[model samples]
Target: MHKKILLAYDGTEEGRVALLECADIAHLLRAETHLLAVMRVPSGVFLAEGFVPDTVMEDERQRIRETIDDGVALLREGGYSAYGHLACGEPVEEICRLAAELGVDLIVLGHRKQTSFASRWWKGSVGISLLERAPCSILVAVGT
Candidate 1:
């Protein structure tokens, strides 16, 4: 029985589905929820540039905050004790870090969605690496 849970919400279709599932599980376990939205910094050019511009950083921060806000609203309206934060870094790293920091017994996330050929070919892989490395147990929810 988990007393605390860490949930990953990225404002994606799959992630939204996971939130509903996490709510069900959390209610059953009477767990407190901690939602995390990670803003992944580009590992290529952005890292080499040393620092991101204030305008770009703020844009990303606001987006992440909105994601967290949505998650917080769901949990609150559902009568769950919930907290959330927006983080900047590698998505996988930040998610895992927040989970451990929260001392959660469970980490919840959605499986990555399939992408179009152009994106699949050009973009980086989804951060599924967190599943393999997380210290706590993970529950993956499928999208509708």
Candidate 2:
């Protein structure tokens, strides 16, 4: 029984599908829902420049905040009470950290299929990585 669920929402179409699935599961189990949005600074940005500008970082944070807020609002509109959380860093790391902190029973995420093998290989997979490090069970909702 999932008493608590953490959903990693990125404000994308794929994310929306995961959100819907998570809502249904949460409704079924009567679980507390949490939405997390991570703000990640590109490694290339740090490599190109010695430091990231405060304005740039702030802008990214604002975007993430809005994204999380929107997710929470959507859940609320759907009659689900949910908590929103925001963090800055790697997505997988942030999700794991929040799940541990919240003591969530399950973590939900959206998966976007990559058609090109090279693109998939170069970018790696968050879902695969989460499987190795997540503290609890994970559900990856794939969009059609």
Judging by TM-score against the true structure, name the best candidate: 2
Best by lDDT: 2
Model 1, 3-114: lDDT tens digits are 9988888878888888998999889989999898888765453555697777777887897898899889989999999999888887778887887787889988887765
For candidate 2, the per-residue lDDT at 14 reads 98
Please provide TM-scores, in order, for all candidate models, with all chains considered together: 0.85, 0.94
What's the lDDT for residue 76 in model 2?
88
lDDT of 1: 0.82
lDDT tens digits, residue span 29-119, model 2: 9899999998888666674558887888888889889998999998888888799999888889999999999999999999999989998
Q: How high is the lDDT of residue 73 in model 2?
A: 93
lDDT of each: 0.82, 0.92
What TM-score would candidate 2 get against the native?
0.94
